[model samples]
Target: MMKFFSPDMKCSALVILMINSFCVFSQIPHKFLYVVGCFENGTTEVQYEYDAEEMLYMDFDRDEVVYTVPTFLVDDPSKLFENLHIYLDAKKAKRSCKAIVVLCKEEEEDPTEESDPPESIIYPSEEVELGVENSLICFVNHFYPPEIKVTWTRNGLPVSEGASLSRYYPNNDQTFHQLSTLTFTPREGDIYSCTVEHMALDRPQTRIWEPDFSHDSSVGPDVYCGVGLAVGLLGVAAGTFLIVKGHHGR
Candidate 1:
């Protein structure tokens, strides 16, 4: 046989059960939708609804729905706003009509694992020309955690002016890439180095760039060859003139 409790006892028991459930639920990591609103009569109502378990956002007015979406993946966006009429009616009966809803999700760490030292390349801009103001870019790719320190040095002295580091961006494989640029006038024999420091490295990695000397090296040979060719043409012209003059004299 089942026993039925009095109305007052049943109400007390229900309240106690709700409180106990709230305590247990609060301990577990879960996403929630928090709603708060005020009515014209100056009464306020606050509600907390768990993600995937409840969809009571309709308790607030549409204008009051002003919260960031939860970070947790939504498996069913179609059902996100479903069953609103029931909650709206319940909220109306409770006299909590105007409200704002905000979705909150627990923060989770990034799933990508930490990686070894990042690969780096230091190069001047493609438009680099001699005696022109240009920038050198230090490209650091395939790194994890997105925490790195980039520094620049010119001719063994630290360069602080006109140096900037770009925001870390994610690569296709979930790794990160960052760029540091140094803007300066490229002078002859200037040695620039880009140094990268990260937790993955026992020592900082550095890449060096110097002005290309191939053009300068070829200039001497080119000038010598041109001068030799001109001298040979002059000798041939003199020989032809002598041959013409001798034939005329004969």
Candidate 2:
């Protein structure tokens, strides 16, 4: 079913902007599902309607179809699954139905002395300083083969460009363990995550970071008092030595 379609090569920026406000209907349509845009807001204005001449997005407020997605056939199962996931996630978050989240699959790593797979790193996350831009991230991977692809993504979207990866092989073992490093910049309220998508797992495994949740900046005052006491004792010793030397001279 056509969720929406454009007509007469006319770009209606105003219509598109207006549709974005409805917040219930998805502008996305596919052959497998209706993928209707809806919310718990008690109105379903962005309903699906198909016309033979062209597919269109109708504005119930203006009583006219103003936009459309496209007309195409995509049969890949992975693509279909990704689409479904995006739609479901959008619905759950109450975000725009037109929002799309790209799905990523990790490449497997196999390493050997003669032929090392992609080097990968798996480590427990460290704590991120609050608002300091350093967030702790966790990753798990043992890439077996060489020339593996490594990427970091949040919410199934690419985060940054540069990533460093390494590999290690044991003396007796034949397979190599891979290591990968990516940025773990933490947001204030949101968590930073490291995901490993080895060819082994059907989906990537993600670990949420634990920031240092402590708000106390000062916790120790006894140590300061101890230092002050030591200084006082040293002063007393110096004064006694001076007094004894003066008395002996007299």
Candidate 3:
């Protein structure tokens, strides 16, 4: 059964519904709602979702409720919490979680079903320019289980410094996504790659990224214009020489 902290924040309470409660096959679509949080470094994030879609979340830093889906509305989102005393309880929950108290447990997936593999891509944060400090972002999406390892490499050598991984984020389809970033100064002919390992895949997935410096794109038009001018001058000279030869023969 789904468990949550009691309203008083002193004990754990079981919610009415269990994860399997919605597992039955039915003609009608089932709507599932969940509220989860992460407490780290004295910070808290309480996210609420319905049908795997983000509805709203409480921003503890801002002490405000932020709406994610525009279609989901309420007269006053804050009013729902004004009298509930949830802010204090959420804080208490965070403390309890840091203390190793289990406020909630993750539901395991069915063993018979196959795991979904994730797809990944590597890209720069902005337009790539050699000799400039920049960051490379490796985005992995549409994976189940929310557990994965990401590693970075430069020129086939393992890279560790200046690399960071973000927390997994849920997608509308219930899958998860994550990002890893590496900071470095771009240099010509430098090759970079991000490799991902997940239980769903038979082997690790690797994506490569490199700076492009074969030629300057900005000089392309000028090069073509110069070539055309040189050809035109040669044609003009050939035509004048033929005219003079014809006149001498006359």
Candidate 4:
């Protein structure tokens, strides 16, 4: 029982089968790449859930597009957009459905404050004295590319002057580096802080230091805590003695 179909009919059946297969695969309409505008303090590229099915891409879409971004990522509370793809409807091949991964900026409540170590930075050992008598300058050094903007802030206010800044290439690390100096001044024992800012991030990385007038050299938290413990023990002993004397009198 060998019956041959007409050439026209055979061609029509093949075309229909191919259309059905396309609808099953590429036409399923699942999320591939997720794009986010900004993350926490120190993130270069916002990460998305790994999807083995589809290829991942940058902020931009399409099959082939590459972008260069700073190592550290964007800041918090940044205005962002969400993206996704939709496939052609199975029932209606002519119409393509748009599947939106709704702007979920507030969906899972975003995230808590990021608690990550800051970028690597080192200050020179030598301290530069400021003309403001008690003031001294400690610089923030950055060895990175893309030319990031540097700023000095005290108590969260923009600071100017009494700052030393420079950039150089010594063929040492084969990389460029920048140093931004800030004038740290405090009366007697007030705390002074140095903050380094990066354009790529929303918040600045900060380090705090307070001058100890009691010691000839600046004593930090460790030494101060020991002194506090000794004083606390003395107070407890004095209270115990007082309570004993009161009981004897009774």
Best by lDDT: 3
TM-score for every candidate vs. truth?
A: 0.42, 0.30, 0.53, 0.30
For candidate 3, write residues 136-189 as lDDT tens digits: 888787775466899999999999999999756655444567778899898977
Scored by CA lDDT, what does every candidate get?
0.51, 0.32, 0.58, 0.31
Error of 2 at 63 (Å): 67
Q: What does each candidate score in C-alpha RMSD? A: 31.1, 29.7, 23.4, 25.2
In every candidate, how many clashes are there?
Answer: 0, 30, 0, 4
Against the true structure, candidate 4 has what lDDT?
A: 0.31
lDDT of 1: 0.51
Ranking by lDDT: 3, 1, 2, 4
User: Residue 50 of model 3: what lDDT?
Assistant: 48
Clashing pairs in 3: none
Q: Candidate 2, residues 1-250: lDDT per residue as tens digits?
A: 1113223211111011112222226675422222232312222222222221112223444544333334354334234234334333423433442231110001112111122223223332333355554422222223332224445665556666445654221111222333455555545555345565554445656554444456444522433343354334333322110000011111
For residue 134, model 2's alpha carbon misses the true position, in angstroms, by: 2.9
Candidate 4 residue-wise lDDT, 1-250, digit = tens: 1112222121101111110122326756333222221212212222222121112223323322222222254332122222332111221221111111122122223322211122423232223233234433333322222234555555556677776665321112212334455555544544445666555456767666554445334444554454454334333322110000011111
